[model samples]
Target: MRGNRGAHRGSPDSGSVTDVVVVGGGQAGLAVGYHLRRQGLDFVILDAEAGPGGAWQHMWASLRLFSPADHSSLPGRLMPIQSGHTYPDAAHVVDYLADYEKRYDLPVQHGTRAEAVHRDGDRLLVEADSGAWRAKAVISAAGTWSRPFVPALPGRGVFAGRQLHTVNYRRPADFAGQRVIVVGGGNSGAQIAADLALDGDVDVTWTTQRPPRFLADDIDGRALFDAATARRRALDAGRDDTGGVASLGDIVAVPPVREARDSGRLKASPMFERLDRDGVRWADGTRASADAVIWCTGFRPALTHLAPLGLRGRRGHITTVGTRAADEPRLHLLGYGDWTGPASATLIGVGRPARDAAREIADLLDA
Candidate 1:
């Protein structure tokens, strides 16, 4: 509906405007950009990062994808794989994302952080660090990296030991020779626990609300993604197809985890009742002197930018029909996970929702 206004970087006082403003430069935003490019929509992608490779650049050094490069790619291009590399590390993913942005010539403005989104008559106003953007529609793909969620426990603040979330964890070397507790039942907790246990000198204990479930050795992220896709398709077709499928939450027994299991270091304890001044206290009144705690809890969607619109529900999520916001048709949310779209948070899974959102926005503007 709007003509192309070639890329430029400056303050919002310049009156920068577009038909669509995609509020992130990560996989979901990039995927949506690809479709918008095909639709010939005038749009700009805003990224807060200093350069390419959105949040992937912040991942832990030892972290690796559970799937191969090809299976973990975005919509248009295949993520190139190096010879003999089964699972790509964070650096590889970062490189691929950077290349994807360049290859598509996506109009992405770096260092532009969206602070708020509100309706201004027929247009949506995005207030960002660089300035303001008045867009016909706004796609909020800001993602969950900024909103790490750590559940509260009794005496949490009284514990003398150091506490950090997975967001701050980079490598196992930092906890060397320390008695550490890794908390969470998810894959992150399993991976981090295994990594820390690899160091013979580090005493690592794992705590989970429930026992962690590990998928069979043959199953990895690829299989999990495929199964999720199939289940979604089946549901759309009015059939239940998840009878025997393993959830994405189940841990894939990557090499390190398998090694940890064989070494009997993969064991996890029931979650401690409370944190004590010196350590953690169990239900049976037993206390372990932990030097540090690592919370592998997941993240909440980073939707603060949309608060001004007053669209959030009780769960802090805006209700969406597919990727389009239920309350605000001109506003769409991407990569906020299952509520927005199935597997929307993963690299390979975001493409479908991105495509759908782009098409929906295109239709709305064309009308």
Candidate 2:
């Protein structure tokens, strides 16, 4: 059940133990794997997907990466560009991932879905549907979207419309000529709403419990990094280590809800107070009907596999940096922060942590 999709790692007897095993072969996983190679560390990357594209292939088809092509490339491969282009779409990004894997000769186990990861004494144990893995250390690059956040709204089941999460959203075809209500006011909400509205005939409406804070010219990005760094420093400085969830208020540098607002597509309504046969009711005595609901309500990091490690924050994220030295020492997390530099949670954003973690792993091995 957990074997690779295409290429296998030669014979089963040929497989050797690795210094580290990274779960989820997305941008973060690949980045870490590449760094580990440079560090002369033997490691393996386990990805659930059939290929190297990570979550990009599963995203909406019309989606073009918001970041530039130069920023999208992984550690080893150059993004293939045409005519000195600007931004690349999902397909281009997918191709770049394939090239990245090939160029680096990364030991990746595609189609191997890591079902569980827990501490087996000093070593770490990783279980996939197809096989079991034991490594000296584990890096969770699973990313947050693996577990979609769908709130327990009442009457969700009986609703007479199609309901989907942004992870499954491919294009506007399902929404064509339909009355759609996009839930949540995060970046996904804003982007999808704008796309649907621009396409016409969709009649998209966005709903949020609280007003989202947006930034112009990526001001929110700077603020988020500063806030996260400050918090991390505070923790290091003995300010407080109460295992609290980093507030979305701090890291959220969301794009302006301008398009949704200016185009009459946004609303400050709470989530489903009630779902009736006719439509959905909000907390503020408002009701709306829709043919589809796309929950851009964000995601929860799935650390279920790591549950036996007994490490978590107040909201259940693994609470550690560069191998949880103070708390769950020797456990590290990437793609789980509001970095204080140019990186956000995107592929480009994960490089810093990957580099740091790889260095730390090398040091540990040397020690």
- TM for every model, in the order presented, reads 0.95, 0.82
lDDT tens digits, residue span 170-264, model 2: 77666888878778767787667666776766877766766654554444333444455566667778897433223534112223245545656
Residue-level lDDT tens digits of model 1 in 1-367: 5445344334476657788999999988899999888887888899998889888999888788988898999998999995678999999999999999999899888888999998899999999987899989999999998899998999899999899999999988898789999999888899999998887778999999988888888788778777777887787789976732454446888889889988998898999999988899999998889999999999999999999999999978899988999999999999988778888889999999999998999899989
Clashing pairs for predicted structure model 2, backbone only: 2-130, 117-305, 323-331
Which parts of model 1 are misplaced by more than 4 Å? 5-11, 241-249
Candidate number with greatest TM-score: 1
C-alpha lDDT of candidate 1 relative to the true structure: 0.88
